[model samples]
Target: MREFKTENIEVAYADNTIIKNLSIKIPIGKITTIIGPNGCGKSTLLKAIGRIMKTKNGAIYLDGKNIYELSSKDFARQLAILPQSPIAPEGLTARELVSYGRYAHQKGFGKPSEKDKEIVKWALEVTNLSELSEISVDNMSGGQRQRVWIAMALAQQTDMILLDEPTTYLDVAYQLEVLELLENLNKEHGCTIVMVLHDINMASRYADYLIALKNGNIVGTGTPKEVITKEMLREVYHIEADIMIEERTKKPTCISYRLNNRKIAVEAGIKKGIKVVG
Candidate 1:
């Protein structure tokens, strides 16, 4: 299995630093979701780990080697990233876009071998996109297009896949569709899936592990039960939440939440002998 970790990495844009001295180790062959409030560096952290953004400090290691030291093709062979709200090139068909995932495995001139074609076909079929293979991505529904992108990542045949907000803008059904597809990948193929998600309940239900972030710092990381608590919700989200164990998933679920009176909550925690961290 490939080992993935970040060691105290700092990421910045121009003069503004977004992530600072953050570190995380992703569990291999499991689905890990990152959740945080807006502008909390969830996307920035994913981009840095996926090598789409350069970290000004520290290093990201994959399989015991620094990622920056690996050849581009070698890195691509091991990992694939699907960014949020990705736009396909105008008029590109689903099959054509998925075929591009084979580029890293191709030789000079990048001609597709028979094996490459086979893998692409398998990806399309696995994503339930075989019927839509010839359809232009621009013409498809949001859910179908998302699956096409996922099929492209699957075509890469990598052990690890990182996604930023894979469910953004999708309706409830489509969101569950994409998440269930990812769950199947992990369970059946042992693909390591890391993604950023906004839906806290969904994250808890679908993720084997959860990383909670706030203001570029990780507030907690562990199984959903360990991390998704009322205390964490208050500290990370500045909101009062009622959490319960979901019967179906046996994971923590936020039943209801409302605006928090930070001072009152902190004082209440103090009175009840609970450590409150913000």
Candidate 2:
């Protein structure tokens, strides 16, 4: 099992800094969820760790070694990342796309080896795409397409996987379906899963470890019970919410929410030299 730790990393796009100096240690062999508001740099952090986005300052360490020190193939073997919107090449079959995962292991241009073919078949089967394997990715539904991409990542056979908003375009039921599949992958294979989630309730329910971010900064990192508190909701989201516990899962759920008008009213009061009361 490979764990990841970052040290004071700063991620930027052009002149805009999406993530400030941030340090985090993701536990080995557990499902970790990174959650925050829309512009909170959650995806930037995921990409940085996956080496898809470069950090201007500081380093990301995978399995205690600096990630930059590892070769591309070595890094791919240790960790894999799936982005929010992956563009599949037109006319690429699901099986063909999944087979790309084996590229890192292939030597000097030969056809897929027997072991590679076995892995690709296993990935397709595990993702329930055995029949869809020959179908074009463009012809699949959103959920099915997402599963195909996930199958590719699984074929990579990395110890850790990173995904940015794996359930974005799907409906609530499909979202739950995808999350359940990820939970199974983590449990059955002992894979370390890290993902960025926009849904707080879903993140709380499925995550073994939760990391909350705000304004490109860390807010809280712990179990859902510790990070999904009412106070945390107020602080990170500026939303007044009622935190409820699910009966069976015992996971923290936000049953109600309303805008915290206090901030706006307080600022208005200050402008008029009037103190606002709660």
Candidate 3:
């Protein structure tokens, strides 16, 4: 597993800086999540960690060595990234797409080795895509296609995997399935996982470490129990809520209260006399 460290990292698009002097460490063999509102640089930070974005400042280190110094093949061999949105090639079977992950491991002038095939098999099996291996990706449902993409990343056999909003198009059941698969990967194979998650409750349930960001800055970093507080929800999400401890698991559960009509009217910039209801 790889331990990732970012120091004074910054990214800008035109005049707006999406990430500013952000430094964070992703602990090895654990699921670390980046949580924030839209356009708060969480995805940018993921791209930087994955080396998909070129940064003008700071450095990202993997296993105590500078990741930028690694060659493309060597880097791909050690790290695999699943971007926020990945499009599948038309008419490509799931197995064929997963086989592309072996590109980094294949030697020049040779076919895929036995070990490569084994890795591909295990990846497909782990993701429960073995049955659909021969199916074309274009015909699959959104959740199935997402699993295929994740299978490709797993087929790479890298110790560190970076995923940006992996559950974007998935239903609730599929979302839990993906998260459980990731948890299994971390627990069974000791893979290091770093992901940008939009759902705070899911992030709290799945991630071992949480990093909250706002306006290109880190607002908090700690375990879910330590970092997810009533104040944090209000500060990061601009919502008022009460935090309670779940009886069974003892995790923090946030309960948001609906604002009264009077407060809602003022917040919505509507006249007091206007009555609106479903």
Instruction: Report each candidate's C-alpha RMSD, comma-separated, in the order given.
Output: 4.3, 2.4, 5.1
For model 2, how does the per-residue alpha-carbon lDDT over 136-218 read when each residue is reduced to its tens digit?
Answer: 99999888888899899999999888999999989988898789889989999888999999999999999999999988999
- Candidate ranking (TM-score, best to worst): 2, 1, 3
**244 in model 3: Cα distance from truth in Å?**
2.4
Candidate 3, which segments miss by more than 4 Å at Cα? Answer: 257-278
Regarding lDDT, does 1 or 3 come out ahead?
Answer: 1
Model 1 alpha-carbon drift over 4 Å, by segment: 263-278
Candidate 2: worst-modelled 10 consecutive residues by lDDT: 259-268
Q: Enumerate residue pairs that collide in model 3.
A: none
lDDT of 1: 0.93
After superposition, candidate 2 runs with Cα above 4 Å error: 264-278
lDDT of 1 by residue, 110-182 (tens): 6899999999999999999999999999999989999999999999999999999998899999999999999
lDDT of 3 by residue, 1-278 (tens): 44679999888877778987889888888899999989899998888889898777888888888888998888998889999879987899998899888988888858888898898888899889999999999999877888888889888889888999999988999898888989898998898889999998889888899999988899999998988987777667766677777777566767554334544454355444565555
Instruction: Judging by TM-score, tell me the better candidate of 1 and 3.
Output: 1
Report model 1's TM-score to 2 decimal places.
Answer: 0.93
Give the top-scoring candidate (TM-score). Answer: 2
Sorting all predicted structures by lDDT, with the top scorer first, yields: 1, 2, 3
- Estimate candidate 2's alpha-carbon lDDT, on a 0 to 1 scale: 0.92
Backbone clashes in candidate 1 total 0
